[model samples]
Target: MQVSPIGTFFGDAVYKYEAPRQGRLFAGHPGRIELNAGQNFEMALRDLDGFERIWVIFQFHENVGWRPTTRPPVPPKGKDRVGTFASRSPYRPNPIGLSCVRLLKIDGLTLYVDEADLLNGTPVLDIKPYIPMADAFPDAKAGWVEEQEGDLWTVLADAPFDAQNRWIAERSDFDLESFARVQLSRGNFSKGVFDSTRRRLTVDESAHTGVLAYRTFRIHFTYDDTARVVCLQRVSSGYTAEELQEGTEDKYGDKQLHRDFITLPDFRR
Candidate 1:
């Protein structure tokens, strides 16, 4: 009964909260799996590149323990918690996870990937090419998920927000635009859409403005309640001037990014 990782995943999701509920939703966020050398894993990876997608069996290394019942990201109607086996909670019995990630390319032992929901440095057990004939089941009934509403809010970004997001992404691994899309796109708006409590977000109906916290950064956006549309306006530093001051504590090691962020042409220093 022995198990070991064939490789390690390097991705932008530094924290658990940064990862999307599903990998497919995190499309455009790229990552790589650096397989161990001298094991002929490169040969193992041969012929895998042609497949557009692959099933990655990985380990949830950060989860502490398993919970019998875990709260889902978007809970079903009238159900606060579901059986651990039912939901894709990281706190599983064995901390094992499976994600179908897009295969960009393979360079030697490094497999370029995208749409990965696993956190940074996650251990990958194995990979298998996805077969559309064997996996396609569009007609399949999704149990609790089917009970939820199907409508999704359209997420847009203004010229300014787009500029700021691009700037930050160039300096860091995170992608604020995609993160916002995944979090704000779907949910029951009547019951506080996008898991406001867990995601640390607030909305001002009067002003049509909403602010979403993404670790050391803040996303400011405006929404049209009637249209179910969210338009990102700008990006800001969550840290105060004092916090970003010289010799201050850098809890997440990203204060420097914020320091330079405030200098954006439109934002005040």
Candidate 2:
């Protein structure tokens, strides 16, 4: 049997690292699923708006190959890995994932969803309404999660960081604040939910400070291990003074963004 995508999801999450652990992590992030124009999907979408949430069946298009076992965010004690089927790792044999996203509205062939965790240009295989009565299994025992200690931390933005994040968000589609929370909230500098070693990050655990690279930008932050609180200090450009100049190459077509960013009252300076 063969499978085909009925639509595509477009959003600000362009990279895997940008995606939150779950859609509920950042409720402000929204996306649109544009179904195939002439496939009569409009009829299929009839009455879907009545539901508050929907199950988005999408493809993990960027992931390649499959792993029999995968590492989880909060791995079990004495073990760093778990069966792939037990975890939500994208490196699956089928490369398909089901994400429950809030349905805001539907216009023409587009379905507007909020708090989406899928990356931009994700191929959507199907859509299903979320029925709480049928889907709600509150007491279900999660194998490893039940055995491990609660591993969630509170993430915050400092005064300077909040201002910087707002300034950048107004100028571009990047939400460094939310990304930082999703990536930093679950783990410390040494061991993170997303794994700091795999990401573009520099950690100074001694000082409780670290810098996380988000695309062309960098986030400076501090963490209180005792309180389990992570606070973002500020955001800086990953570009140099020379790279932001007019004569430099615009590889990612974001040189202008960097140039404009440097003029933000020298916030990170």
Candidate 3:
């Protein structure tokens, strides 16, 4: 059997980590799937506009290989490892993915979709309309997934934090707000969820604060033990003054991009 790509998905999720774990959890970066006009794909898309959502079958272009068993990024402490089939691990025998994305509109050969988990330039193999009658399984047992429920925590950003996020957005390629939401949304921060092995987040009991490293920046925030909410305080560049002066491009690779971020007034502070 052979499969060919009918279209390609385009979005701001340039990196795998940048994408939301699930399409339904995605917070609003809309993308487009532009089908090949020469392949008569337009004819196939007819009457699909009425559907509220669509299932996008795409290729995981960036993933090179697979692992039989892998540890998930945010698994419950003792139940960290799981079979590939049981988890939505990107590394699979077949580098194929399916996402149920909200169909916002259709313009000619292009489909504007929201809540998309597809990365930029991901090859779209096929598209199918989401039928609620057949697909809805509200009472279906989800096994381990059901056990993982109730772990989700809330995140709140104050006005100053929002301002800092906006500042970072203008200067860097990173989506600071989305990254914070994804990292802090489900963790058991109250009991000290810092993973020393991964060094993703470091919690300071004395200061009642936590710091999460994202690329070349550190996200400083405070987590409320009782409220189970993470309040972002500020963002700081990891690059030293000498590194900024000498050029971060040689060290960090994205020279101009790093320079743009380090030179921001917020970074100076």
Candidate 4:
């Protein structure tokens, strides 16, 4: 058995952990799949543009090994343990992944897609058009996944919070608001939401607040127990002035471009 990469996926999700758990969930950025040139790949993509969505078969190149049992992030509070095959855990025997991404456009051998959960530089093994009648099964039972409530909460950023996110985006390449939305929308604030060893969400009894840490930034938010709403208060970057200054050039490009973007009348509002 032999396999080779036909193309590579390029997107904002540079790290595996930063990618959304699934496509159609928190995919806020578009990505490009540039097929290898000189393989007649351009001719192969002739009629692909007509399809609205396509199936991307890719390899989980970052995964090192397989696990027989894994705990999924969104399992019901008490029953978190499940066989690896039952969940979409990346630590699979084959290390392969599948995603249905919306095909935005096609430029020669390059494909523009949205709702992609793959990380940047992910090797794409194959691509196929998605057929609605053949691919969709809305009424099919989803086993244990169906048993969970899986209710997504409403995530909102207040004016000040939005401002803080914009400020952070200008300084760094991170999308604070999108990351916050993805984390808080799970509505899993209780202690049992995550495994005891890997605690991702923490609540402060005194302040009635919950904090989700991402990289060097901490997202401050409050979860309403009654309303079931997660209000984003602000995003505080742990990067020092020197770190931010350095990132401004490397990650965010020219400082003037960021300044111009931040000062725009529309962005200011």
Candidate 5:
């Protein structure tokens, strides 16, 4: 079989199958793909910032050959492996990869991105801007991929699937107001005490759907017309810490507990 060359990528892009199967993986461990050496790197990245997200078409420079069937990160039902075309595994006959990466920032020809599953220095063939009206599907069905959708944490909590091998640096500077707004929208709130003069809120959202089935966490937030402060609380009845500890267990039931929430300091800093 003869395959026409689409285009060459610059430096080998970062490969991160470690990324969640979907774009929501941004809040998780994310890496980058530096493109600047394959073929026409600068020409392809021109005016890329105009798009909030971009569809990156690239080659699986690492994939050696074809495979009839491959194992997807999450196998459906009783199926462990499916036809190559049925899944997005890089080990395919063509070995082509398509990723819609969130355009974080752009500098000249280099595009900094998030929610990218690519590896460091992976080759990029073509780039296309993403339009929400066309790219987002409010009623779209993912077929087998749909079964894999759930709480981003639960899905990504468990090695390759859980980022067990990767190091997650706790980002201490996440904007509290922004986090408070998000939590408030999810309807996780209850009135409480504040810095002595003002009242605060403890937001809690408990539902069996989406992800995090045994949900029991609260966000300590206070939002005014100006700013907001947000913190975390264990809300799983008598089981918050226990469940979290269980969720972080390794694939082989190791003792190392995966710290779920970033433990907040006792007194407000």
Candidate 6:
């Protein structure tokens, strides 16, 4: 019954670990964990240079509840809903998420990581080194995941923050074409009939456009050609289109939001 907020997430941008079965699914897409207000985040990471991978205990901030049975993204859409603990869905009652990510490098409090399957600003609970012998189950039987046809770790940096200020300041139209291309490269959209249609859609409305949840960002793009921005809201359980739009507008609207992208590149020492 104990719970608390982990350190806030930071990096190029909040990313999606699309189809990770375990943390091993991603060997790239790095991230970092920074202190929220009072703690000394840098000191805690001072001795972490030698490790290759680490376990990240985080909150499924967007997950809402648990169900006795649920359908995974794998094949066979309808299946018996199993116990909540049996699946990796973020909707569990506790909403705690755990993943093992590779450690590429550490600069002060900033950690260059790989295989980070987390949303932007995910609250980190703790960091522990990965012990392969103790963690991996080579003969593990993936009850339903074995049939899934995709890898979640396949990600690319999309949703540009370059013109974020312009969009916020001018409230003018901004195109998501290049941004969408980047996301597509990372395999964000699934290869299904729904995806086929969703990707081809177009949007040209203001109400439908909004910022991403949890971080300083705003992405307004068309989905299924219905004039709505693809939802980039962050949550453990899931998000509503309205909620996603609201979060984006409420948070990201300043110069500090884009500071990391500029500062981190030069602080590598």
Q: Write the per-residue lDDT of candidate 5 for residues 1-269, one digit (tens) a residue.
A: 65434333332222232223444444432444455455576776777778888888877777698889976544565666778888887777777789887777776555667666565546666678999988888897767866541122211122221221122213222222222222232221222211111113322334222211111212232222112222222121213346446445444332232243334232211
Q: TM per model?
A: 0.91, 0.93, 0.85, 0.84, 0.48, 0.53
Q: Which is better, 5 or 6, measured by TM-score?
A: 6
Q: Write the per-residue lDDT of candidate 2 for residues 185-231, one digit (tens) a residue.
A: 77655554456544577888788898999999999988888898888
lDDT comparison, 4 vs 5, better candidate: 4
Error of 3 at 131 (Å): 0.8
What are the runs in model 4 whose C-alpha is more than 4 Å off? Answer: 194-200, 240-269
Candidate 1, residues 149-195, lDDT tens digits: the string is: 43678999999888888888788876889888877776644456466
Candidate 5 global TM-score = 0.48
Ranking by lDDT: 2, 1, 3, 4, 6, 5
Residue pairs with colliding backbones in model 4 are: none
Q: Least accurate stretch of 10 residues (summed lDDT) in model 6?
A: 232-241
Expressed as tens digits, the lDDT of each residue in 141-176 for candidate 6 is: 977656444333222233443334333334422223
- Ten-residue segment with the worst summed lDDT in candidate 5? 190-199
lDDT of 1: 0.83
lDDT of 6 at 240: 32
Instruction: Identify the superior model by TM-score, candidate 3 or candidate 6.
Output: 3
lDDT of each: 0.83, 0.85, 0.78, 0.76, 0.44, 0.50
> Runs in model 6 with CA error above 4 Å?
12-28, 36-43, 76-82, 149-269
In model 3, the runs with Cα more than 4 Å from the true position are 76-78, 170-174, 190-200, 246-269
Candidate with top lDDT is 2
lDDT of 4 by residue, 132-207 (tens): 9999999998888876644677888777778867776766677877766766676456544533233255787456
Better of 1 and 5 by lDDT: 1
